[model samples]
Target: MNEKLHCIGCGTEIQTENPQEPGYAPVSSLEKEDIICKRCFRLKNYNELQPVSLTDDDFLRILNGLGTQKGLIVKIVDIFDFNGSWLPGLHRFVGSNPVLLIANKVDLLPKSVNKNKVINWIKQEAKNLGLKPIDVLLVSAHKGSGMTEAMEAIEHYRRGEDVYVVGCTNVGKSTFINRIIKTATGTGDIITTSHFPGTTLDMIEIPLDDKKAIFDTPGIINHHQMAHYLDPSELKFIMPKKEIKPKTFQLNAGQTLFVGALARFDFIQGQRAAFTVHIANDLDIHRTKLEKADELYANHRGELLAPPSEKYIDQLPRLVRHEFSIKEAKTDIVFSGLGWITIQDTNCVIAAYAPEGVEVQVRPSLI
Candidate 1:
């Protein structure tokens, strides 16, 4: 019989019998110092599943403290799901402090798109959203790509300052911090990085020797995120990952598309607009004519449409619609959690949908 221990990642006590939760370890490995077992280890090292949710109040309390400190604020963003991973009201929370934005998951973009261009675009986009970040670095937190550069940036700006890593849940925030831990310090720290979702429920500070330290806060779980309503099996089908090969569908007015039950997009006006979808590479996307979409969705939501499965179906609200005209330069009809439909710089009427209570807003297109 194997004894159990708490997981190094989430500090959850383990039973070893149930492999479903974090911290599952055997008696031999249970007492190990860095006892993060296979489950948490995979989630931390690879981009594996460790779904945990946090509340808004808990998230805001952590942010409010950042302004009082004198450290570099490293704001992280998901390159694959940029819109979904950005925290709203972040600018107000950080105050006048200098901010460095790191667009994480760079490995997930199109090969043709220049990496520098994407970083620049994110920098500009951040400003338009009222956040004047001091610098922006692109990195693939999963593969340790550009992590050194990000560290250099953090070190240069840190100036013996406290560091705050900010990102919405699932933007590789924990992974990036772990990288920061390994490179900046070494592999000897006791409280190391392993993914178990928002590991730092409160602000967990790791000292940079005696003078400086990195403060990691619990990831702010967007109440609007699909992850909250989704099971582990469902998220893989909905979220996009690497180099989003934009799925394009020519839609006549009154056509509907479902982004794995996370969002519904309907073409309401204009001459057959080109609907460009950006999502995780793994998720299944289904489309049908508006007249039949509702019926199809009802019949095949869990089987075909997926994500918000029948188990969580009743939890999902009736999809609400927001009608808007793309009057600005290349506006993206941002859907919470799923991804966005890039509307080219043209005037067109579009209707967007998500489960009720999740706020959806359009921003300048990234591409």
Candidate 2:
């Protein structure tokens, strides 16, 4: 009989068979006296991320236990994909605990974006989702910006209680925790950080003081996110690694824009106006006549218009149209996990298309 071993970082039972799943360690590493899994090793050494899966029931079960614990819930959200990153029924899991909302990835937005306006929008969106955050702090876990403010807020609100850091996958929760740990303890040691969902299978705790600790929980997987549909290689083209340089396109009433093969936007009845796009700076954007849009897509889906390459075409949901009639102010047509288009034409009608389950929303412009 063989003795079972577990990862010291996330506590998942270690195995060597699958590299894509959690608790994976190489055969050599598994023989060591003290070992961290390969996922945690990569995160600690290279700051890289990987994805893993967890059932909805497992996620709910972990969160449901939080209600019975006494702590401050620090819910991290990706500013770019708020709706897609939000964990549904989060309010039910926290009981009466106060939530400190930290909006991560502020560095990805353009410099012209107003922080105050963005914060206000985040508050409104969270409220609409039935989450009443005690304080909302915007920070970039990657750049180490606005983290001091987040720490101050956590110190003030936590008030000697244990803190549970929670969020959906890919929201930068693990990176944020690693930053906090490095800042507090003056150590480069990091908890596992991965782009994949379910990176943390069990709670990994770091002592905040002699009496209290901060626990990093596993990220709840959101199936609607494009991250779940796209391959790891394809994600680099969609997910922004650096600040986005907004691409402005002047389009007529009959023009259409294609964002790789992941999404499309049509100027149905809008005036000749500029539509500013905010997406990964590296993604290719193409413009064509609206009449030829369907034909172009049909011909070049996995070729000229890529991302849903030949291998992923069958897995991707069919594009569904969401018609919007802009009324007063500037509005953003958001395609979840991809990017958004900001338009300023009043009484203008536009149509945004994305995968069927992925959310396409209209909100007041952030810029």
What is the lDDT of every predicted structure here?
Answer: 0.70, 0.83
Per-residue lDDT tens digits of candidate 1, residues 1-367? 3454566666666556655433456657765677765555654565333433456665767777777667788898876666667787788988767898898877776665566667777877787778988888889988888988888888788877778877877888878876765665554434344232333343445667656777676667775565656676667766655567877777788888887767888887777667788777666678888889779877877667767777877677777889897777567776666667877647678788887866577766656
Q: List the residue pairs that clash in candidate 2.
A: 49-194, 50-194, 50-196, 51-196
Q: TM per model?
A: 0.76, 0.90
Model 2: per-residue lDDT, tens digit, 55-90? 787787777778888889999999888888988789
Report the alpha-carbon TM-score of model 2 versus the true structure: 0.90
Show where candidate 1 strays beyond 4 Å.
1-57, 114-117, 190-204, 327-331
For candidate 1, the lDDT comes to 0.70
